[model samples]
Target: MTSEPAERAGVPRRSLLLGAAAGAGAVALGAGGAIAPPAQAAAPFVKGADISWMPQMEAKGYYWNNSSGVRQDLFTILKGYGITAVSLRTWVNPSSDPGNGHCSIEETAQMAQRAKNAGMQVLIGFHFGDTWNSVGVQNPPAAWAGMSYSQMLQAMYDYVYHSCNVIKYYGVTPAWVKIGNETNSGICKPTGSISKPAQMTGLLNAAYEMSKQVFPSTPVLVHLAQPQNLAGVQNFLDAYRSNGGKWDITGLSSYAQGGNVPTVLANMQTIQSGYGKPVMQVEYGGPVGKPTQVRDSLRAFVTGVRGFGGLGTFFWEPEGYPSFNGYNSSAWDESSRRPTAAMDGFLNV
Candidate 1:
């Protein structure tokens, strides 16, 4: 779940292959023609950050400065710090609630294009809600609230299909597509609740299948929060397996408050072994003030995960600075208007 006080806060096979390869330092053609992908992706271990707050932040006059005090794009600064990929969040029909709104399909496409322009791989997450959805809250989009289970499944398919096409239209192909965000309890709740395992898995399967249809080679991730809860994670994945749900990867959100790095790492390894799926830390963050601690912790987590062949680790909203949607755990310093040492964790990783 987000820290906000307000509420919380694609492609063909041949072309798809090139897009994925482009994410790995190869040249691939996009709307703007040939572009080199991030070299870090070539390493095959993603060092990523979720800068989904960027569009809104820029709209609010927020910008970043390089280490030498030179103004630069946030993506440029992140790449300099060794970030190879970016994760973007999407909402069905979000409102303009500042902290809680504005990550609709259109905004997601624009951000994906910006990431592609910066030579970074992209990961797109679908919340399937008009607002925030996470372990604690999984409200169905208002438009689907009154629909039957069958109707909801169709809606999920259409939404994913349309969203993928928009991203493709923007000439950006995602390296990873997340079926749901932090869906520990299940997505599109009540009917799609964990208690209703079959129904829940059915909805997730719909999103997963739609993603495959659009981006045949892209991996679809099933994200859950708090890996420290081993039993909870197992139960969630077990439900998917038992219900015949499909997923290409297992993603997780592990914050400093959620558990220690070793604990999270161990749990992830166990899950990977038990489920036979690759794992990635899809969301993570540390206290902004403790730059050294944050840096060391992030470095340890990523290194440990990589040691075990874990896909990658991503810092959640690292571009978020103090007072941006009431979030303050960003790797950036508001006063300095530059990235804090915490971001250096990705350096040389």
Candidate 2:
């Protein structure tokens, strides 16, 4: 669910709120004042965490202890570390996984309230489906199961508009909203797939238009995975624009894989130079135990993106339990559920 162009032409306005730090558990990544609160808790350069999973984790009786090994409220601790923003993902009608209370729209609003109370900017990441919509499978909500391509566009529009209003009514207007999640194959696929370029553009355009109508000032982005996959990024965006798609910022994903940091940075530059769109590393993660290298890699990534006028770098689930989808490198100390040394990159920036 997502809107608008405060950007040049078709690009969306960008705030770049993602952190490129390692997964967090315990022992905050850095020890310094450099990781000050997000520019007085403003909109741009919002330093923060994607602890959308926190609420669900809480429901499952999972709690994090502070550096003192005392259990503490998570957001309070993040704020203490100068984390000034929070991100959440909502599905059209998400599944009720026992550990997933935060995926529902109402539940997400509840978390948004918590984030706002913690003095953090909120980002509404709408996957626009019943579950995660990523590069592999972009399923539409069951509600749209039998709809035609034209009908799907209207559904997207309505979904986004409704998501905007829900968050706004809850007293936490999102600073950013994504039209879809990791939509390299296009969103709500098959008819709305990038393979069907024109139809996909229609779907995205509908979401874009309806989002602006609801929250005209909020920036909207189209997310894609693997910034290092330059061809994928280029092809998808080009297809979107050529088919009359509109977006504000170009949102990307980057994870440390086989020493791909340089390629990630290079791809960001390529997107900026080729599309003239401000880039935002919306998702990044590094090795969990390798504190020194993780810190340096994250720093280099943030620095590299900065060199090319990127909005910012964001870590996907740095504080995740089970190390972010079972990849140990992606999470901070799962036991502590706090920051690790890799967070030094975000802090010192």
Q: How accurate locally, in lDDT, is each candidate?
A: 0.81, 0.69
In Å, residue 89's CA in model 2 sits off its true spot by 0.6
Candidate with best TM-score: 1
Angstrom error of the Cα, residue 280, model 1: value is 0.7
The positional error of residue 28 in candidate 1, measured at the CA in angstroms, is 28
Model 2 bad stretches (over 4 Å): 1-44, 99-102, 257-259, 323-330, 336-338
Superposed by TM-score, candidate 2 places the C-alpha of residue 339 at a distance from the truth, in angstroms, of 2.8
Q: C-alpha displacement of 210 in model 2, angstroms?
A: 1.7
- What TM-score does each of the candidates earn? 0.87, 0.82
Q: Could you tell me the lDDT of residue 160 within candidate 1?
A: 80
In model 1, the clashing pairs are none
